[model samples]
Target: MQQLSKSHIPFFVVLVLCFTPWLQSPSALVLGLILSQLGWVPTNVPIAKWTKKLLSYSIIGLGFGISLSEAFKATSSGIGLIVTTIFVTLILGTWIAIKIGLDKKTGYLISSGTAICGGSAIAAVSPAINANANQTGLALAVVFILNSVALFVFPVIGHALNLDQHTFGVWAAIAIHDTSSVVGAAGAYGEEALRTATTLKLARALWIIPVALGSAWYFGKGKQKLQIPTFIFLYIAAVVVSDLLPQFETLYHMTFSVAKQTLVACLFLIGSAISLEQVKEAGLKPLLFGVGLWLAISIGTLVWLLY
Candidate 1:
């Protein structure tokens, strides 16, 4: 058998990953998980760290895509629902975790993901809570899997219920765990739904800052400084700059699209880092907790928002 060198394989994998045509977040997510399980890549590769940084950059790019003024208009209409659903989900998710004997940190991670922005929320809050990579991975896996299902399923349900574009957009923004899937589902519905959902979801994503600080306080033992997520501020700045610069609109849209694509690559990195040990650490309880909390937010919010 011929021996393959380490340097060449990763470069090729990365190249192919970069160019893969259908490399959306869900696909990238699946590919990453498969690679990790197969043990194809060595553990020493810094893709995980780099991917995390790329994700932050992607958020900044995401800001350029969303006009702050537009976001505020959408946000103003649904601010009460977004805020209430997030806090309620957080409290209920934590309560269920405690009731089921799940890890509190895991509960918080899952809840944060469900409440704010799926894997992005997990990424933002994990460091604040001092969660290990494996812990964050587990929470992300739970949320990512659900986001995939919701991406497709949500549209069907919306149509079945005959929800108006704005209503479905609000419902999706309130219910879906990840921004990508929330946008995906809404985009499937219509451009108006997509616009409304994206704006509302980004505004909802703004909650990550406070949630991270809250995590630091509640989970950390000693006195903790209020560590903020810097990327969020950059994200806001991008939104403002893009909105202000009329001539640069074309470039801004292109960059935002590139940012979303990079985020898919980031998902691949995140998926690759998920070890069996991490999955085992997650266990049945946390998964169940995720399921319960997701159902609560999905069903509960759907009823309240639609009616």
Candidate 2:
């Protein structure tokens, strides 16, 4: 059996700190990134898989804190904007990618990610499009870099614009790449923003199914079976159960609190998965494509929200 070495110590230390009250989402992400950059992350652990599972569980747990009625309200109110932005981002992003001479598969993956739920969308679409490792990794790398930036930059922009909780929450859910970053940025903004963003983001995530299948058809791989994000159903169930069991309000609240901290840890795991090599592998055109597409969606959505 492989044993833990001195190099693994820093990773564990920072990981434990992620659960502490003082370390917030952005700090946890930065710490994890630092650990990876320093080569302190243990190679044995499946950090990416673990991050995905933990994030799913944390999202479901967060559902317990939300009222089913509010979830419905938030989702219903934002359905039009969510649908519109997803299609626009995908179309505009694809056009920009082709114009910039990026690889088709890589461009599509990045565009799907920006259009939907970031890494999740890319992961789902990659297999359908039969993207090779290099292509998939590059797409993920570009999205991750942008996701990290959004985590920090969105809140600052939100405050600078004096956006209210609802406006900022909507903007973050639409503009941010991944659900983790969306939750992190919105949570930092305020509790109302957190609730709004989480619900809207997950609602947006449902589009992954249709988008993935469409990608398979578009890529002439219609035989490929799509992996549905079943956790979304679990998340909805969590909200339902929480709403039905008000007698267990204390327990639900406790789970919600723990889940938020767990999400912080998930961000750390996600950050640890990123490396400089991945960034370098992403290359200039794809990175520029991602940044440009991200900027367009960010600004476009913010403008629509404001006006």
Candidate 3:
């Protein structure tokens, strides 16, 4: 096999990723992970490093800056209804996924995608469970497929329920598995939904820091101290700094876009990591479980939002 330059693949893929319209943050992350794994992009590049640094600055300097700048602007009832829908879906999906024998690790991943952020949640949980690369890849794939469907289906369902833009945005943020999907679905409805959904999704993402740290302590007892993930700290720092300072505002925003683009490139790498020859090894069981879990969340959310 011919050897490829480290920068060559990433540079090429980055070009493609930059041009593509990533509808949501998770979509970009999924794509970035896949491409990075495939040698289609350079994972060793400074993108992740820069993002980490930027995020730290944002969190500290910016003061956990609002992800949903406009979400609070919505009517109280609309936001409450959206929150209720999300919580209900999360409970129902987790129960269903577990009842079907999905591994605890995979179950958490699916639940995170259903309940909070998508790939980020999965990434956070991976270290806690010591999830294999293939398992992570598969979980991401399942989330991606489900999110794509949610993009179209969510808007229609929201419309059918006569939900306003703010209400729909909240629903999209709460129900959609990935941030990108949330943005896409919300944007499909209107600018208000787009803004609200992004904010809501970001707020949900904040939960990962605590969850990761707790999971690390609980699960990493047998492992070496260094094995404990420190990235969560960086992620939190990033959020904090960005929210506190106005001077670094441009830097924070720049990194935000770059992070999203890098993630898209990562998705292509992840796609290559999938062992096509043995794709069926996980069998129909996990796939079926994932499907059922996804449906339960969707149906459950709809019911809560309507009733």
Candidate 4:
């Protein structure tokens, strides 16, 4: 009789367990944290240092998450303009990010955030773009920082313009990067904005599946094969289940927390890997590229959303 390989069992478990409807967000986060931290599962790098830093910075997520949820509940009114905003902004922003010399990976990450759900979009795309852990970490850092800033700033902007909740929702979904941040910003503005922003962000999140498949096809055919991030399905499944259980919908928040923690750990690993010397040695090329692309995407996305 032939025996099953040990690796196959783990693979099967990952595939099956992740799909179970009972699995919650926090559960996934815990699993990811364990796998990333311990040797229980392997990663391209160790994340202990990064995770520590992330924990320190996580107040950003905690504040952003609760506010964002509040915004969604309050803004149950707008729908049409929100869609238009997301479509227009994404196209413009992506073009700008790419034009500015941001490497394809960083450019895509920034654009995805502005165009869709922020950090989640970047997190979803990082692996597909073959981004180094550092690149992912840096991009995540930028998004969260921006989200925190937006939380403080966006409502003021909306108020200055005297924009209605629906308009602000579209703006938040189009311009903001993490859902929590979007929620925070939108909620600050109004409930109409929150609902619109969340719906639009969710719509944008769907893009990851196709993008992942396309990326796998694009990069895998060459000598360097890329693995699709199948774990995203866990996020999707969690969303679906959360939607079905309004009574326990906060479970999504738990997942969000978990994902945020894991991501922080990932960022810590990235920071440890990044050397001041390497940033200097790259002789401004990568820095130029990264910054330029980010600005370009930002401008382009803004144009698309507005025009």
Candidate No. with top lDDT: 2
Q: Per-residue lDDT of 146-191 in model 4, one digit per residue for the tens?
A: 6677788878877986877876777677666677777888887877
Higher-lDDT candidate among 2 and 3?
A: 2
Cα RMSD (angstroms) for every candidate in the order listed: 3.5, 5.4, 5.6, 10.5
- Global lDDT of each model? 0.78, 0.80, 0.61, 0.54
Q: Candidate 4 regions off by >4 Å?
A: 1-100, 221-227, 241-256, 281-307
Against the true structure, whose TM-score is highest?
1
| Model 3: how far residue 48 lies from native, Å | 15
| Per-candidate total of colliding backbone pairs | 0, 0, 57, 25
lDDT of 1 at 167: 85
For model 4, give the 10-residue run with minimal summed lDDT: 59-68
Q: 250-282, model 3: which lDDT tens digit per residue?
A: 777767656654444444444444554444666
TM-score of 4: 0.60
Measured against the true structure, the TM-scores of the candidates, in listed sequence, are: 0.82, 0.65, 0.70, 0.60
